[model samples]
Target: MEKEDLKLLQQKVTKLRAEGKYKETIEACYHLLKSGKECNDFKSILTAHINHAASYYCIGDTEEAFNSIEAYVEVCSRFGDEADLLHQYNVLFLLYEYNKDFAKAKATLENCIGLGKKLEKYNIVSNGYSNISHVLMEEGNYGAALEAGQKGLEASKLHKPASPILELRVKLNIAKAYLELNHFHASKALINEMIHDPILESFIREKSQCYHLQGSWYRKQKIFKEAFDSLTVAKELVESYRDLYLLKSIQEERCQLCEQMEDVQLGYRVQKEYISLLNEINKQELALTALKLEIKHSMSDFKRKANTDFLTGIFNRSYLETTSKEWLEQASVKDENIVCILFDIDNFKIINDQYGHLFGDEVIKQVSNACSKTMKENELFARYGGDEFVVLVRGASLESGKKRAEEMRGIIGNVKIEMGGNSVSITSSMGVTDNLDGKVRSFQELFHHADLGLYEAKKSGKNNVCVKLADKE
Candidate 1:
């Protein structure tokens, strides 16, 4: 597929989702994913995965939604780039909040807000704060909810193109805080403003929200008939979108209103619907928890595959360089020493020539396994290149680093490979570098000093250990 075709498909899916045509959206996203996969367009694939998950969720297929989202995470972690992990987390917050895990929901929103600020996506930041306010309202922190909602309102205005819907949403959230705090006049004013807006007539979701809040206001004011009318409108609007969360809320409120009116038959009917919705939600909540645990293991494996060497089953150089920067910076801040151990198999090239490449590969794997087995605490191990491995440690001194190097040397010496009914002994030359004088400013410097030490070790007969310090020669 062409890039323009992919972009057009994505826009179609987004439009369908915005219009609440979830079934159609799902179909569109499926086609998008298929095309993206055929063309190896990971960004399109990622968009399809997340959209498909959300569409499935809206249609009440919790299991399928979870499964789809797991695939999304697996793809993102595997590809490393073209991953909107922030958006993934943003979507998960809805599920988390629905499941009543407010803390986790808040944490995910916090992540979204941080990413949004970094990316200069003020709309996302506003949406996050607005959601945080809603969560706070759910937890009965009306004061804090008001503060967050105001912040969301402020943020929504920061975007260049502006988002009218987001501004309204933030205001609605603020009204929720007002209603919960018994500031009836304040809440009623906002609710009335949205309910009468002609522009919102086509926005079923927003209109439903306005009616939902209006109904709440009526219910609190003891105007049961008006409350019933408004809530009925909300229920009808929400049902069109299959927004189970909102549908459930409307049903629960309707049930309460029936009870307040003392209409026994009406109350029983509404109660039954509410109970059914609750049962389905409860079942989905359990399924979500189980799927998350299941996906955790899969995601771990996916991440390992992305970062690990294909043949040696150890961390690869790309992962090493990317991760070491963070570790080195943290170690520097803590005034801790960083140690680097570099080594290579003895006569690895000659072994490949004499015994064949197969034996050489086996030697590398066995040696890596041996060295990894007795790895020092906090050590970062990786295959730096062909037949060469590096281990990094933080908060370790020069003496301990040398001792660790010796242990790795011994472990490599013990690795015996069998070839043609004969056992082959392998040894490795080791070079260790440490921040002995706190001058090992970066991973590059650390690796350079370690390379120097390895040269010395090789000169002293390959099966030896040599230690060097940064800038000390």
Candidate 2:
């Protein structure tokens, strides 16, 4: 693709991903990757993988998102792109934290800070310290968390254009640390200032956190009425966004609502109501937990009807249309190397005429079985009409994807159906491509490019595998 073509694809995919269409975003990234003349050795590969990984992260595929990020890191490492490395290291730090690898998370953040210092990128340094505070907080080192957050704020002052979001994050971390250390006055000062800040209007979650912390401080000071007011606002704010975690925390605090009140009778009445509400909350939480467990088991049942093909009992065209982009996004989410493998039976029309429709049905079913045997457990495989099949392989690069396609072709060819006193052989032409290029907007477009490779495979004779990385033009 030309520079203008790549830019156009980027803009289109950006719009799609911004619209929360992660599947489309992943496909776009596949095109982006294809546009780069040499993704395994190119600078633009960074943007391609970043966009690709973010989509994967958004779609609950952390593994693939991280894989995408790892590739981004690998390319950056090769080019000595420290600035990009510094930022992506934060991403790696968070990934480690998400996986409860606090030791590695802290180390990654330290590395980020080191790169920031080397590059003199104060904003990166500030964010790195702020992240260190998060790890420290997780490790129950409140004093250290507070110190790191203060360092973050100090570094922020030097980062030009100023990041209010970063500043607010550091302050929130500091306030929490102070409260944990029983520095009531210090925590209160930060909370009071932030609670009324105009910036909080655009950051409701931060505002809610402020109110919740304020309520906790007031409650500790034996000021129940003020605590109640703050807690109520916090509850409203958290519930507005349906933030279950914050809501639950607020609810837990709200349960002791009437403590330290002068009016004993009124306090008792309010306490009783809160106790009842708490009881209801506990029951609801129990029900919610049970429902989640049940859904985990029944999810496949829900998907099978709409997604499965009746003939081969594999995924249908509809499934591919609905899920390719989603699978792409999911692949990108985990920073996973995602490969789209497109293939079709060689001389299928001739086979249909020679062996008749019944034999063709048998061939299709057997081919589907061969595909199932070739691919991994959770790979997305679907019949793309007639004899064409599409497999969205997550955690695989173009190289691995070709291997898988070849395996499938070989397996399908080895199968012979003896019918009408004759035996039949099957072969496949395949095309494989990756989404790391950061080009294209949907899986369809991504698949179409892979199809170009398939067309080449056909030209190279029946059973051939071809890959499309970037346009030779």
- Candidates in order, TM-scores: namely 0.62, 0.56
Model 1: lDDT equals: 0.85
Consecutive 10-residue window with the lowest summed lDDT within model 1: 291-300
State, as a TM-score between 0 and 1, how close model 2 is to the true structure.
Answer: 0.56
> Best-fitting candidate, measured by TM-score?
1
Q: Global lDDT of each model? A: 0.85, 0.78
| Model 2 spans > 4 angstroms off | 13-19, 37-44, 162-165, 240-242, 256-473
lDDT of 2 by residue, 1-473 (tens): 56666677767777887787766677667657656633342645666787777776655467878988988887777774666776588667767887789899999989988888887788888988988998899999998999999999998888888778668878988998998899998998999888878889998888888898889888888888899889889989987876665676676676566544556676676566556656766776686556444533443454575578989998898778777777666655566667888899999999999879988999999989876866676588899899999888777767878888888778877988888787877888998887773343378778878899999999988698999874422
- With candidate 2 superimposed using the best TM-score fit, by how many Å does residue 131's alpha carbon deviate from the native? 1.8
Residue 411, model 1: lDDT of 84
How far does residue 213 in candidate 1 sit from its true spot (Å)? 5.0
